[model samples]
Target: MQYRTNPDYWNQWYPSDLISESFPGQFRNWFYSLLVMATVLDNSPPFKANFTYGTLVAEDGRAMHKSWGNSIEFNKAADKMGVDVMRWMYCNHKSENNLFFGYNRADEVRRQFLLPLWNAYKFLVNYAILDDWTPNGETLPILDNVLDTWIISRLNQVIDKVNTLIQNYDPFNATLVVESFINDLTNWYIRRSRRRFWRSEQDNDKKHAYAVLYHVITTLTRLLAPITPFVTEVMYQNLVHSNNPPQHIPFEGEGQGVMSHESVHHCEYPKADLSLVNDDILDQMSVARQVCSLGLSARNQAGLKVRQPLSKILVHMGDYHTELKPEFVQIILDELNVKQFEIVSKVESLVAYQVLPNNKILGPKFGRQFPKIRQALVVADHAEIVKKVNNGESISLDIDGESVVIYPDEVVIQTKPIEGLAVGADKHMTVGIDTIITDELATEGMSRELVRHIQALRKEAGFNIEDRITVYYQTDGDIANVFDTWTDYIKEETLTNELVSGTHAEEIFTKSVKIGKHEVMFGLKKI
Candidate 1:
C-alpha cells in the first residue's frame, strides 16, 4: 500500500530513512524479506538513507544474556541511572562501532558530565534564589568582562557546530560538541564568574553574568531535548516556566524560545547567531587554557599543588599562539595559583637544549659522513634546531659551509634545568615553576590549606553558603603564625565572623589534620 499507485497519499509510508538492528544475517533475514516483497511487487528500493547501528556488548566485550548473568534490562538501567545518562551514552557513540554499554560506563558518564552539569545548574538556582533574581525574558546584555563575552561566543559556536552535524544525521559528533559546551559552562564560565553571583551588589555586571548563564543553559537544554527529554524538561520547567513565561524570545529560523508552552519539548530548537561567534576570542581563550595547563603541569612536576603559591611561572613562547595579554595572564595566575608569570619570547631563554642524533637511523643514512652529521648536530644552533624538531619541521644545519637537513625523527632533544626550576613543555607551550618557596609563600599556602579544610567542614556541617561562622583552631607555634599572618584572608574566604585560636565546644564540626610535623585542629560554628 505504501508504494501503491493512487491519486491520494501514494508512497505515504515510504521511508525517507531506514534504521534497524544490524546483527549478523539481518540483511538476509529482515531486509531480505522486504527485498523479496518489493521485487515481486515491482517496487524500487525505498529508503533515501540507511543507517545501520552496531550491537551493544558488555564493557569487557561479553555479549549480554540472562544465562551469562551479564544482561541488563533497559527499563531497570534507565530507572537506576537516568534516561538522560542512557540517552547521552546512546548519542555519544558512532553508529559503526559497538557501544560498550553497562552500569560501569553509566557511572563514568554520570560522574564526568551529568554531575558537573547539575552542579552548574544548582549553583545558578541557589544563588539566584538568594539574590531574588527573576528572569525578565531579557536577552543577553553586553558586558565588558572577557569571560562573559567568551562564554556567549563559545555557546553560539557550539550551537552552530552541533546543529550542522545533527542536520547531516550525525548525532555522535553533535553530542560530543554539547558535552564540551557543558564543560565550558561548568568549569570555565560558572567557576570564573562565581564571585559575581555571590557578591552583595546587584550591579549590571552581576545581572549580565546571570543572564548569560541563563541564555546558555536554556539554549543548551533546547538542543538536547530531542535526545534526552526528561532532565531538560525538569530544568526548563523550574528555570523558565517557574521563573517567567508568556514572553517571546525570537530565535533564528522557526526556532523561538517558548512564549506559550510549558514543556521544553514544546519549544522550538535554539538557533545559532553566527554573528556572536568570534574565533579571535576563542583562540585567545584557548591560549589562556594552554598556559594554565602548562603551568599546572610545571607545578605537578615541582611537587606543588595549585593551593601552593609559587612566586612565578616562566612561559616559553612559541609562534603557535598570539601574545598573552595582561587579562589572559591574570586568568592564568588565578587558575594555576601562581603569583606572577615571566613569559620569554625565546625558548632558548628557558631551556638549554641538547640535541643527539639517532645513530641507528642516521648511521646507515649518512654512511662515512655520519661523524660530520654528529658534529653538525653538536655545534649547530641547538636552540633553533630543537625548536624546528619540536615543531615537527626539518632542521637545517650548516656544517663547514655544507648544508644538511635533519628531520625530526633523526634527533632526540633534551632540556637542561634552569636554576633547578620544575619545567614542563608540550609542542606549543613550555612553562617552568619556580621551586623556591619563600617563607611568605609557604605561609600563604598553609593559610589556603586551612581555608580549604574550613570550607569542607562547613559543607559537612550543613551550614548555608551565606552563613557566617567562627573558625576555631589549635595548632603549633609555626602554624599559629601563619593563621595570624593571613587571618583576614582566611576569614573572608570562609565567611568567618572571627578566627579563634582556642578550641570551641564539642558540638561544633571539628577535625584534626597534619601539616608536615604539626597537628592542627579546625572547628566551625555557625553564627
Candidate 2:
C-alpha cells in the first residue's frame, strides 16, 4: 500500500518527474512522511501541530508520536491523583488557553480545589447515609420558604448556564458556573442547614433537607460526570447503591448479589429547560451585583469594611430601572450591607459637565457665521438656549456682513456641576457620594468592624458554631461606649453567652489590636 502510493510508482505512471511526484497520492504520502520525520527526528514533536495543521489543511491530523516525548500520558497523572481529579482539571480548562501538561500545576489543583470538592461530597454522603436518605424520583414536596425555592431555582439556573456554555464551547464560563454552584452548596446551603442534617430519628425537616441535598448531589454528580469521570463514578456507586441497588446483571448473571460497577461516564447529561431560566430575573440580579461590586469598591476606597452597615445607596437609572429595579433592590441591600436603599430620579445631581460638539455641522451651513453662533450660544443662559432648542428654532447670528441661522442639532449641550455633592461623571454616566458621616453613623461603622473581628476570632479559635463564648474589650471614649451599647450584637455574632467589657487579662486566648486612637480586646471559650 505504501509502495503503490510512493512517488516512484507515480513517476512510472506519468513518465515525468514533476507530473508524477506532484500527483495527489505522492504529495499526500510525502506530507505524511515529512510529518512523521519531523516528529521522529526532533524528539520534541510540536503538539501545536494539531492547531497549525487544522489551519493549513482544514482537517484534524493524527496524534503526534510518543517517541517524540510530546505525547501526554494521562495514566501516570491519574495514578498519582485519581482519574476523576485529572478529568476535572482537563474539562475545567478553557479551550482558548494552552494547557501545559506537568505535575506541579496538576498537584496544586488537586490539593487546593479538587480534594476539597471531593471531601465536601464525601461529607454529604456520610451524613446522608446515616440519615437513611432516599430519592423516589417523584414530586415529593413544594417548599414554601424563600431559601429553599431560591436554591432549587439556582440549581436549574446552573444547569441552564452549564448547558449553554458547553454547547457554545465556552468551558471557562461553564467551569465558573459549576464552581459557583459548589460554593453555594458548601457555604450557603449546607452551612445554613447543617442542623437539619444532624437532627435525631425521623424528623420531617431533616428528611426534607436530606431529600433536597440528596437530589442536589445526584444531579451534581451527573453534571460533574463529563468533567471528573472516576471520582463521580465512585461517588455515584457509593451514594446511589446505598439508596437503591441496581437489578440487572452485567454479563449474563456473572455475579451473585453483589452489585456490578456502573460507569458514571455513560450517564446522560441533563438538558437545560429554557423555560426555567428567567432572563428578567437574571438581568435584575446582574445589575444588583454590579451595583454591589461598585458599592463595595467604593467602601474599600473609603476604608470601610462590608460588615459595616451603610445608611443607604442611591442608584440612578435612566429608563432601565423600571425593568431591573424590583429584582436588584434586595440583592443590592444585602450585598452593600445597607439598612435601606433610596431610588432617586434625575441623575443630574450625580452628573457634572457634558461635552457638546465643536460646531463642525454648523460650520458648513453658516461658514464665518459659525464663530458668532458659537459665541452667542456660549454667552446665552442655559435654560433659554434649552428652551429655544426644545422648540426646534435656530439661533440667528451676524458675522462678516452676513446673517445666518444655527440649528440646535449642529451643536452639543453639556451639564456643569456647581457645589455640595462629591461628584464624578463620564460622557454617559455619573456617580456621587454623600460625605456627611455623622457620629451615629461612625458608631454604627465601628460596631460593624467589631462584629467582623469577632467573626474572625470565632474562626481562629477552632470552635464549632454551636460553642458559646464571652467577649472582652479594651478601649476608651466613643469606641468603648459603642461596644457597650452594641454588646448584644457582639454576643449574637460570636455565639457568646455574655460580653465582658474592660482590659481583663485572665480570659484572653487571642488578641486583636486595631491601630488607631483606641485599642480593643476580645476572648472566646467553647461551652
Candidate 3:
C-alpha cells in the first residue's frame, strides 16, 4: 500500500564520488536536502503512486494516549465477548463515521438481538419436544391464518430490505432491520401464537403455526449467521438439526426442509420471496396499530386502566385517513378492551370549535383593523366558523359598510372535547374514549384483575405455567358478586377445575388479595 518514487535516481545520484565531493561539513547537509527534493521531482521512470492522510484516533474517536487511559487493548476487548461480537459491532458502523466502542454498546447487541434470537430458538425447541413434533418438510398453507400470512409477509420484506442494504455496503442499517424483525418475531408473532403450541391436541392450525415458526426461526438464523456465527450456530443446531434427521434431505419443490447443515455459518444467505410480501396488508396493519395506540393514549387521559374495558371507541380519520378492514378494527378493539369501535366521518358533532384571529396573518394585513377583526372573531358563531373552515371557505365581516374578508388561514381553530369523553388526536386521526363504566364492565374488569393476581400468585407459589388447580376465595361486598358473574372466565383463565367461595381451611398457600375496596382470602390447590 505504500509507494515511493524511483530508487534508481537515488542510486545514480548517490554514487561514492559525488557523496565524497559534497561530504564536507555543512555542505553534506545541503546536498542531502536537495537529493530528497530530487526524488519527488524525479518521475522520469514513470512509476505510479498515490497517498492518503487522516488523523489516527482510538475507537472512541479520541486521540489515543496511555496517559489519558482512552486506549483500548485489542485482546482485552476480544476477551469480553469474544471477537465475534466486537467484529459484528465494528462492521455495523458506517465507515465514514468514527466508531465509539463501549461495553454498553456490546451489551445492547446481546440484549436487543442475540438474546431474543436465542430465546426464540429455545422456546420453539422446548415446545416442539413437548408436542412431539418433527419437521416432515410439510408445506404448510400460508392462507391457514391471518397471523401466518402477516408473519410470512413481514419476513419476506425484511429479507428484501436486508439483502439490498448489505449489497450496498450498509451493514449498519441491515443489522438494525434484523434487530427490529427479531423484536416483532418475539413480541408479536410468538406471543400471539403461544396458545396454539399450548393446545392439547396437535390440530391442523397448531401444526401450521409450528411450521411457520420453525421456518421463520431457521431463516432468520441463516440471515444473521454471517454477522453472528456462534450464537446462530447454536440456535440452528437446537431448533433445526436436533429434530431433523439425517435422512431428511427434503423433497424438491416441497416446503423448505430442516437444515441438516452442521453449523449456521455454512448455510447460504436467504433470498427474499416477493410473492409473500404484501405491502397493502402491512400498511393496513400499521394504521390499525396507530388507532390502538391513540386509543390507549386516550384511555390514559381518562384515568382508565386497560383491565377496565370501555364500552366504545370513536376513531376520526383526519386528512391522511386509512380505511381499516373489519379484522384490523377487531385488533384495535381487543387491544383496547372496548366492546365496540366506530369510525367517525365527520367531527362537527364530535368536537366543539373555538375561533381566534391569527394575529400573525391579520396584524400586518389590516394593521389598525386587526382589533376589529379579533372582536368579530370572538363574537362570531364559532360553530358557523368551524363549518366554513371545514368546508375550506373564508369568513366575511362588515365594519361601517366596508366589507372585509378573512381566509381560514387567518384564524386558528381549536377543538374542545365533549363532556365525559377523553379525546386524543394527532394529524393522522382523533381517538375518543367513553370513560363511563357500567356494572357489567366493572365485573369483567375485576374478573380480569383477579385472574392476573392469581397468575402472579401461581408463579410465586412455584407452580408451572400449565399447572391446573382448585380455587378457594372468601370475600364480602360486590367482589363476591363479580366472582359469581365471571366464574367461568376466571376458571378458564386460571386453569381452575373447582371454585369455592364460602370458606377454606388455613394453609401455607392461602394469601389475602386486594380486589377493589375489599380484601379477599384466596388459595390455590393442585387438582
Candidate 4:
C-alpha cells in the first residue's frame, strides 16, 4: 500500500533487506513467507529480503532475560561508560562467539586501548604546543633509527590487516588489529622515541618524530571512524582540524575546492604503504624485547631493582632464536641497567643443571626398573646430560644389565643458577645476570634514586618538563662522595642549574628517602 502511494520511492528504493533482530529472529522468515504467499496468489512479485542470524548472550554466558534478572540496562551503561566503549566492545567481539559484556570488560577496553591512544595523542599535543609545532606539507626525514622504521612498517601492516579483515566482514579481527597497532605505537614507538621529542632543540629528528606521530594518529582516526564514529570524529577534529583549517577536495575551477567536513567519517580510509613494511627488522626487535624482558626478570628474581646497575647479562638462545644486531642488543643494555651483554654459545659456566625422571610417565612404563632408572638419572653426570639434551640427543643408561634409553621428553631438566648469577629462561632463550655490585655501581644507583625523588618533587611543584631547578641534597659519607663523583650527571638529568651542598629552607619542596643504608634529605626549588 505504501509502495502504491509512493511509486517513485519504490522505483528508487524497493525491497529493503532487514538486519538480524535481537531474539526470536526466525519470525522474520515467517513474515517473508507470508509476503511470498500473497504475491503468488495475487500474481504479483514478492519483495526480496535477506536475513542474518546470531545468538545474544549476557556477560556471564547466559541469555539476557528479565525473569532471570540478568538483563543489561544499556542506557545506564552508556551514561557511565561512553557509547564508543560499548560500540568498541561489540565490534571487537566475534559474532559467532558469545559476547561477555560487563563493566570490567569495558574498563579493560578503556585502560588497554582507549587510554593509551588518548595518552599518546596528548603527549604529542602537549609537546607540540610547547615547541610551537604546526603541521606543514613536508615529508618525513630519512630516519635511520630502527625504532622509527619498525613502527612505520607495523603501521602499514596494521592498515593492510584492518582493511582486509573489515572487507571480509570480520570486524572482530579488524578492531583487534587496530588495538595491537595502538599498543605498538604507544608502548614501543612513542616510548623509545620520547627522548627525541624531549630534546629542547627542534631538529630534524624531532621533526621526523612529529611527522610520524601526526600521520599515524590521523590515519588511525580515519581507520577507526567506521567502527567508532563519535570518539574518532572528536579526535580528528582536535588533532587535525584544530591546527589547520578543514581539508578540502578539488573542484572543477582552478584554486577552487569545497571545504570538507571535519568529521572523521568524511575522511577517506588509509591505504597501506608496502614500501615501509619490514618483517625482518620487526622480528629482530621482537627478539631484543624478549631478551630485555628475560634479563629484567632475572634481575627481579635476584632482588635487584632496575634502578640499580649490573655488570653483564649472558644470553643463550635456541636454534630458532633471531640473531640480533649490535643496535638491538644495545636496547637490552640500556633497558636492563647492565654494563655489558654477551651472546654466549654455551651457558655451562652460568647455570647448573639436574636431570630427573618424569614420574608421571616413567612410573607406569618401567615399574620395577623405575628405581634403577631414577638412580641412574640421579648419578648421571648433569653436564653430560645437559650437553646431550642441548644437542637434541637422549641419554642411555645400563640398569641391572638391561639397557634403557631415556628420551629428553621422559626427563625433566631443572636449571639452577651458579654462584654470583641470577637466571631466567623461556623455551626459546636463557638470560643470566651477574649480580655483583661495586662501589661505583652502588653510587650510581643511589644517584639515580635521588634523581627520581627530585623529579617527583618537580612534578609536585607543578614545574614543566623543561623547567630548571636548584637542587640541595644533604647526606654524608659514600652518598656525598657519589654526589661529588656523579654531580654533573645528576645535574644534567634533573635540569638542576645550581647544585648546593646544604640543608635549604623548608618552604621549598623537601623529602627524605632512604638511599642505600643512608637516609638522605633532598630539596628542590624551581629556578
Question: What local distance difference test score does each model get?
Answer: 0.81, 0.59, 0.75, 0.78
What does candidate 4's lDDT look like per residue over 260-342, in tens digits?
45666765677787777888888998888888888888988999999999899898885546778988888788889899988
Give the backbone clash total of model 1. 0
- Residue-level error in angstroms, candidate 1, position 377: 1.2
TM-score of 3: 0.78
Model number with the top lDDT = 1
Those runs of model 2 whose alpha carbons end farther than 4 Å from true positions after fitting are 1-85, 92-98, 102-154, 157-217, 231-268, 273-275, 319-328, 354-433, 502-508
Compute the lDDT for candidate 2.
Answer: 0.59
TM-score of 4: 0.84
Off by over 4 Å in 3: 1-88, 198-201, 247-259, 320-322, 355-366, 372-413, 502-508
Winner by TM-score = 1
RMSD of each: 2.8, 11.3, 9.6, 5.3
In terms of TM-score, how similar is model 1 to the real structure?
Answer: 0.91
Q: Give the TM-score of candidate 2.
A: 0.61
Candidate 3 local lDDT, residue 433: 83
Please list the residue runs of candidate 4 whose C-alpha ends up more than 4 Å from where it truly belongs after superposition. 1-24, 27-72, 246-261, 375-409
Q: For residues 416-465, could you state the per-residue lDDT of candidate 3 as single tens digits?
A: 88876788776557788888899889889998999899888888888876
Q: Model 1: per-residue lDDT, tens digit, 375-395?
A: 888887887787688678988
TM-score, each model?
Answer: 0.91, 0.61, 0.78, 0.84
Q: Least accurate stretch of 10 residues (summed lDDT) in model 1? A: 249-258
